[model samples]
Target: MDSNNTNVKSNADTILIVDDHPSNLQVLFALLESYGFRVLAVQNGENALKIANSILPDLILLDILMPGIDGFEVCRLLKAKSETQHIPVIFLTALSETVNKVKGFEMGGIDYVTKPIEHRELLARIQTHLTLKKMSFSLACQNEKLQQEVYARTRVERQQALVGKITEKIRDSLDETQILQTVTEELVKVLNTDSCQIELYDEKLTMATVVYEYIKEDSKEAPREHLRYHGKVRQVIEPIYQQLLKKIPLQFVSTSLDSKYTKLACPIFENGGSKGILGNLWLLKPSEAVFEELEVQLVQQVASQCAIAIRQARLYEASQQQVKELEKLNRLKDDFLKTISHELRSPMSSMQLAMQTLEKLLQSDYPHYKSPKFARVLEIFTSSARRHNRLIENLLMLCYLDVKSEVFTSELINLQIFIPEIIQSFSARIQQQQQHLLIDLPEHLPLLSSHAASLEHIVVELLTNACKYTGPGETIGLQARVTDQAIELSVTNSGVVIPEKEQHRIFDQFYRIPDNDPWQHGGTGLGLTLVKKMVEVIGASLELESYKGQTKFTIKLPNHHCTLS
Candidate 1:
């Protein structure tokens, strides 16, 4: 072939030219070469087919008359084959007859040129076919891209459906084991993996256990091979676990699997305050098998739901244990209180009987019965004993209320009559304090439905507190009235004001107000606490307000009516 290899603007569009005449090849090659085309020239049809198949050129120029296979035959063979069929073909012929030109077009020749060729016509025809070829190639590429996008969107929809199933499973129950098992099973199906395992870590991070595991029955790998409990396999998980400790998500090619298999893990996280990675969702696959990015992302999403379920179940179990412990302690305290109270009462009764006998003897036969000095000592002894007895009774009452062991039977008590009786019981103390006592008693105060014994104790505690706290000549008042909603009873004292912060704890057993010294007040501190519990048992509310040098304790009895009698 005649050759002139000169620099032409390179579009790199390769055109394969076939003709029996070397002159024709030379002229056409030079004409196409100067036009920025990459030209490959062959003088015979056999070589044309070979080069076309090998190079798969963008366009082919073939002469109709050749030795072994004619140009029509060459185009026919190219069209028949899969690899070279897309190439555009143009036939060259010297014959001007319409029949031969028609024959060329029928044989899959895209265009034809009369030979002793017009260089310009040949060039123009070549340019037209090359443009058409480029446009066809571009269209094919766009079609392929569109198909890929459709496939991607379909995959995402399927993955989302799988996520919906996972969400449903979580909403069904908070059982940790069930949630993990369902997760592993779904992972195997979605990932098309050989096996899956969910490993859990202890709070201290000192230990890891496989909480759930799965293996495909048809998988060739043995169950033991997939287990991480053994030798070097555990080391593979150590780094992933460390990543989880930092709350960072990670995925890496795993070497723990046999060379024939591949493994991947995604961290599972806990729900609440300190969000630590609880464990990992581990997936295994045959080495030749492929796991796409979409599948990996699906596992991560499902893993999140698993974390929440596990955390909830753990917290619930811990709360149950705490509740049981509190109940046991409460029961033990109730038994101890009851036993001690019974033991204390027997000695107290004997002391009271002995004191009475001594008093009887003094009055009847003792010489000091008429002496003032003996009389004073006996009065002091009797006072101390009575106070001690009252303390013991308060303690026993507290024990009953603490465990809800006392059954309260409500009775109708007329407050008009009841209030005066309670005040009369403290008559000696009221006279000795020399404090002005004011009673605003109503004639028709509403009757209270309550346990009478408990109500009596409540009233006495409030009255005693009022008497003790008020200074000499300060006003101490007891008031009773009926309200639209309930019965209101209050005791007020003018001298002492309770501090704000101490009021909250005033109703706690044995909690005396700070600096209200026991020596001065002479109270066991159980008085107010006992009062509160008894008030609650009878369905009443107690309130205390202290401000501007005055304090009032009020009790509102519920409106539940008992028999008027």
Candidate 2:
């Protein structure tokens, strides 16, 4: 109804009025409302205390002399309470005695006012007390914030100190595993954690491997094997270690919220990457008052030490691994060169002699071969040249797919057309040896996502393998089907069953099954390896199935990633 009511806001500071006088309450309520403040009027001290606690007014105006629980006692109770103690109380009474003023102050009154008040002085006093109350609250809030900041800084510093100490040990010590192991121990002993372990993240960063450490309560021994787990735990935790790897700090759960919870992870980081985590068990949340200087500093020191040590271990592992890898590479090159030289020389010499013979015969004889005998001899020479060329081409392609490139152009195409044509192309040779070829690919299907050249090459390689192994008159079968998110294609051949041990290594480049038996075919011994490389390039995987009378080379291509041009 008034200008004061028009400006009444939700954020307006609330004031409680305590006086036994009804007329005074009414007058003050209107006056307080006019000034844009919320007013709660109470007739007695008892009601004043009750409403002040319930409503949580920003300020309280009390009349010193009252009927039962007077203003003095009411103010005392308000100040004693944990919740209401923050409310600023000002006494308003007719008693202008210095004794009364002093007594009011002693009873926790922030200020005093004389009754039968002039409206202007009353408003002024109210305004002054409210300003003081606001300032007091602002100061309290700032103080709390400053304390939090100090605690956080101290925590960081403590962690840094811990890092420095561990870094000294890591740099000086030679045992990498022990250093990592001790970090867990230090976290448990120093941080007072119930359980802790440093887990290794896989290359994908989507799984955690508890390297050498198990979560068993009784044994408390690091496992010889790597224990792995995934899902939500990995999602939340891996980022922390990833940060640690960059030497960046990614600290989680610095307090008691996870105290009673079974699992807790505190990651240690350096230079913005995750090296590893500082694992712990039975760790309780820090005391709220943990900023009691010493505790805060200690917590930060521990965190720092753990981070530095993890980083140091990571660096050491990387350097040592590089050295060992280079040594291994040296050995691989030494052996590969020897084998390639021997393999290449045999084909080169044979082809060179045949070319020399053809050159001599062409130079001396007529250009047109009219005789049937001449044409038969020419066919044998041409067949020999083609076989040698095929071997060389397969070898080079294998090397390229294995060592030179990885990317494959994605597309959807018909395996049916390609597979059948490929079989038809090999039909003459199959018939020459009285061998049977089987084709089982379905007609026009969903355009499967894959690479055409790589897939065709894999099929050719598998068929070549089948031709080499199976005897004359045996059956070679080509089959294709879609399974789950993959397209499965298989090339099956009868006879030449792969042994168990050799089956595992069949895809290794130039790994031949040693045999003096004429039934066993021989080559540069890299067909299956080439097939694997091509299969992989096309986003498909290859597997072998071999038993007594049947052998199949199956390729499983991931179908979900397919896209159309």
**Which structure among the candidates has the greatest TM-score?**
1
lDDT of 1 by residue, 1-565 (tens): 4233657444467888898898888888888887778888998888899899888989988999888898889988999999998899988899899998888878888999887799889888888988888898899899999989999999899889998887787756657778777888878876778778888776777666677787766565455544443112243345556776665555545555445556677778743446867877778776666567887788877878788787787787788899999999977887787788788888888888888889888888885655788778888788777877888888787776745525667777887788888888887877887878889987656567777887888889999888767777788888886766777789998978889988898898877766653236577788998888888887889989999989999988866744344
- Global lDDT of each model? 0.79, 0.68
- Per-model TM-score on C-alpha atoms: 0.74, 0.41
Candidate 2: tens digits of C-alpha lDDT, residues 87-204: 8888898997899899889988888878887889877877887888789889999999999999888876776676566556655655657766665566555555444565555666
Worst 10 residues of 2 by lDDT: 223-232
Our tally of clashes for model 1 stands at 0
Candidate 1 global TM-score: 0.74
Candidate with best lDDT: 1
